[model samples]
Target: MLKGKLKLPDRLGNLVVDFEDRDDKIGGSSSVLASSEELEIILPNGLGFSRHKDDGDGLCCTEEKKTNEAAIFRASARPYKDRAGSVSAMAFIAADEKRSDFEYQSELKKNTEEELSSSKQNVDGDSDGLLRRHEISSEDHPLSLGKASVWNQYFQHMDIIEQIDRDLKRTHPEMEFFSGDTSFSRKNREAMKNILLLFAKLNPAIRYVQGMHEVLAPIYYVFCTDIDEKNVANAEADSFSCFVKLLSDSVDHFCQQLDNSSGGILSTLSRMSELLKANDEELWRHLELTSRVKAQYYAFRWITLFLTQEFNLQSVLRIWDSLLSNPFGIQEMLLRVCCAMLLCMRSKLLSGDFAANLKLLQNYPDVNIEQLLHVANDLSPDVSSYCPPL
Candidate 1:
């Protein structure tokens, strides 16, 4: 396993690897390490991996030649002096601290009534995160989900998006871009209404949810290539129908959340809660004991709307640029944001515990978004003695 990992690059993410090893000097003498290599990743079924050559374009300049489902990575075995363990270790430590900070912020929610009352406005503001003020409606921001004409218009946007997606993959091998056929161009409000009806027919479990439109906002931006692009002529009918099918499939993540045990919006927020508890037992206990568990409700909308409903639309766009471009890191980024928000209300949160803590947390959003961003970006590791293997 060491030899195999040594053959790859010094950084990896979202991949799993298997290896058989018995090394007393390393983690243990276990015959098999389910995950032993820190910098190695196993490719998922659809991913295509390639190596960079000194004279080559590094897989970004051209489309992948091999479409195979499985492959191993290798590179020149350079001297150990070239290792970037410090930098990689920093990322791992940052991730761990992020987990701890999330717990700390949650615990801080417990405080006295006086502090909670004064901090109430902040909590409401933070509950929404930074929301975009721009509103999309049938008249101005019309999206025709299922109509033939709307589908055609939507295709024009998809073409632009698909081209960009392919280009990005070639240019940035580390990033992933998703594009599926979905239409947004509607000829009329009636067509748009029919599209929604169709969406319901396809998935009866998901009646329309308010924030879903915002969830699909990226597709609109990507498809149209610009927010300024107005409605265009609808395309061929056959192409439009195919595109609608894809659109339905593409938006499933948001849709799935709608049907989640908790409302769809809350489910993603809960995903963070579940992950934190599974990964950090001590911090979880601290939060429960402190009576700060209600922070989850305050943090819910930030995840559901992708922070679209909380701040200026322009700033929200920048946040989305980070969130969509790096889905893997966004969850951690969110936890950091939660911590930063709590820090802004530290006076209130620190005043007391238990019932007081819940009251304090109720008024969370009073902190400034800019301050939250700074804390999130500069967050340090939580310094726990029981640091687990990454």
Candidate 2:
């Protein structure tokens, strides 16, 4: 008989497997590990094992005769990484044809739930650790139920709520999910509202703002339309997690107190001006002198709202794809995009005066998004140098 315990790393979370060998068969159960949605097992000597969902049962071997010969077993909670770099353990096993079928199903379900709980922990905590102290409550706001509370937390933030509601009613009017008061629309609105409320509650410093809905719309839409149907139901929860991740990087722009901080929008605008000067000094000089346009006049909206208000929905989404995908962070990509937008309308911008240039920038003209992104990417290779330190 053999008995031992296995330990996984911090990245893998706490996963322990305890095994015992008896009567030529080995049995063990794995403690829940992070991201354990699916478990993969490899039997020694190329013996195959298949699980049947129709009838809950113990794993079945491809060849009945080889079952008795199976002496070594390896199970992984996730895709196996390189063993050389990964921490691992070895255990020997013998397959038993008479193992309890119900026990296997019960264990599988328990493992799944543990993995889910672990995954939620990762999403909630995030990389910056801002979310660690905040606890999300399932209790519906009093406004949702129309029931008054002692503190009136919901009522205290009614203005923000009303703004969010009004924006939800007006946003993406053409899209079915955002258009009517239908079930889908309500679900999306509720998701957005809940996220904003929780965010404000968690970080009172940045609270809810008017244009935040626009910033959150695309993220919710993308998550809700996930290709995996299993994930669709949890779209709202997942979107909340992702929204927090996005905001963690750019939250300074939304906080007025941080205006002069290195991470703030004012600093971002200064960096944008530097980038423009480097990329197109003549165009930069023209905008500053002839148009009397300063970075803050237009960049306040562009930087804070992430250009969401400037471009059409389709174009905004495309630009966001580039912005989010950039390894250098959103601010650097944003400045480049701002520069590209200016350069794209160089002729019109240079020819226009103060009012005309301001109008053109505030009401950005519709341009080929692909071309715009291409131009943004084509800016100086050392764009990072111009970006303010985070």
Candidate 3:
């Protein structure tokens, strides 16, 4: 057993790890070298694939006729790489950190104390290596169901995620951009499916998670909606390139090991609560301190899925405009947007009890998308001087 602390690198998060399993040089066998792709991802997710089916990547882009306009449009639009630092600042702060605006410091301190009392490990221990033996094959050892399930889930994660992506890609069928009972719509879905699959294949660390297609939808839509026909035809290639750039910073959210770290979704939720307290102290106290509502109860999906599930497609598209354009970074801007969401419902959240407030946030009421963006932009007025019109 390898006992020392082994620090693994993260490519796409350092997904692929090459390990020397053994030093035996029998017949110069290169097969002894184990890599991230030790096992093939073969779980069927409604989308059929024969054992011999080609990866479908080459056919996706080559089938379209190459055009000079396509190349030009690709260069002009989707400035994600150039505008890399797009989010607003102050993203993931620990519960007790100092803030600019007036906040409920005492109550926040109490909450942090309560969290530690639960024996929850903080950022330092978030990515602890697996300690327990994965397999116990002895005839005398009865199988532990818990360990078995964990083993299976860890190994089969890619397949399960592929199945999930298959289902989520069918979202909003009524929309003209991605669905319909026509050749055009089918072609669009195919292109999107290809992009999603390509992304998964490229980033083995985070193959595909549910609601990711939602992240891709607006990007694909914007590309398809391009006026030039060649650019429209070349949407898949352009979207694929831009999508990779778009998710580069936010990929940590997809890594389960980092879930509790400063980069994970929980840390983000903490930052969201902190942002709320900094802006609207009473409302923040009412929900977290008085009502004892955890940010994860409602904000989990919002923060993790980029608010795609909480709002409709059009509203989501509008929200992404602000998120992608912010100068801070997606994570920081996301916390601000989440805080703004709570602020928008200030009157309701304040008067309501735990049950009432929980219901309201879980089943979030219809919101003014433009106004929500406005509130997010208004947060931390001291740091940012220019709030772009949404």
Candidate 4:
């Protein structure tokens, strides 16, 4: 059900299973193929049987279904759950953020012992073993690989954005429309342009710029993949155009001319600092004198785009998975991530005076990507609290 001018990886053209080296077998030898709603994974001889059940660990391939000549692998639930088979599918993309596919695939596969003993549970540990899993988990999300799946999710997000816009428009018809039909290419473009124009119109405080691409990339990918999956006939170009509109809308925030003071994330940080100062005075003073200024250099992108640039694509997708599902009131998961990062750097900050702390945090890449992700996951008191309402 993919649309126009689609390109899959060359190796993915025809799936091949390499079992020549191993003696294990799946479905009593012969040839076994597994089909999910999304893809078909073929198994050659020698790959052992994998169950399609959630045995506390993760989704597994369960049983092989038969039809006269050949057998197809289908997911199965073990003892308790009704749609046990569905758990396999659910592992890939669960509406429940805490138990979703992204959360299951951790990064520290081989180096489990090396992983920080922090309370945070990272989806992907920094192991070579989990890298592929991390990639697989977020392959469906836009932020991971920036494929069509991202476009699909974007459509859902846009639906909400438009829903909000329409509600606002009824009260004020002069308000610009933010939604567009996935099928109408030209209209989608026009609609998006109007939307961007409206964003500029609405937030005269920010002007259009090129760097907004980073934010729009994830949105567009989410929209495209979501649309393709839902409506099968939606044009890829149309989804892309809509994404462009989104970028156009946020252009003002990234304009180099805009300083930290006006409407951008710097403003958000200022507000956050004020909130912290009032709420956690000691932490605020420590951060201001030490990590805060350096945080400005490193934390700007994190705050502005929600760590989209800081971590790799897979990590970003999973992070957003938690972020989009957050129910907490702060409304910004990125802020929490910033808080987590500062916490991770606490030892360095505590060791030095304000200047040393600034020097250390700014120059040192002490917090690896995997550690940061773990901290991000753990920092949120409630994992469910990090995800914004869908």
Q: What is every candidate's alpha-carbon RMSD to the true fold? A: 44.2, 32.4, 42.7, 39.6
Question: What ranking emerges by TM-score with the best candidate at the front?
Answer: 2, 3, 4, 1
Candidate rank order under lDDT = 2, 3, 4, 1
In the range 167-243, model 2's lDDT, one tens digit per residue, is 88877787888767789789888888988888887876678877888888888888888898878888878888988
lDDT of 1 by residue, 1-390 (tens): 544534333442211122222133366665444453233234544343454333553332222422221133312111232334423334555789999999887777744555767567666677654343666545343455544444544564455444433432232122122122223222222233334444444554554445544444333334334333342233222223533543442244356555454434455455555444554555545555565565455566565445655554446656655544433354555555555555555555556666666655544444455656766566553433223322
**Positional deviation of 106 in candidate 2, in angstroms?**
60
Residue range 56-116, candidate 3, lDDT tens digits: 6322223222232233222322222223343211231222245532277767888899977
- Pairs that collide, model 2: none
In angstroms, the error of model 3 at 17 is 99
Relative to the true structure, candidate 1 reaches a TM of 0.34
Off by over 4 Å in 2: 1-154, 381-390
Clashes of 3: 7
TM-score between candidate 4 and the true structure: 0.36
The best candidate by TM-score is: 2
Q: Candidate 1's error at 375, in angstroms? A: 3.2
Q: TM-score of model 2 relative to the true fold? A: 0.59
The runs of at least 3 residues in candidate 4 whose Cα sits more than 4 Å from the true structure, single-residue gaps closed, are: 1-207, 223-264, 274-283, 290-295, 329-331, 352-390
Worst 10 residues of 2 by lDDT: 15-24
Candidate with better TM-score, 2 vs 4:
2
Over 4 Å off in model 1, which ranges?
Answer: 1-198, 214-271, 274-287, 327-340, 352-371, 378-390
Residues forming the 10-long window of minimal summed lDDT in candidate 4 = 12-21
Candidate 4 residue-wise lDDT, 1-390, digit = tens: 211111222322111112211214443443332333322333434244433446785443343412210222212212223322323323433456655544555544534645643212343554433333234455575565343466554554465455434432232122122233344433433433344444443553553332333444345445544644653335344544554453442343465465564555556566555544544467667767644454466566656555655554456666666665655432355566666666666666666776676655445453465576566555524332233433
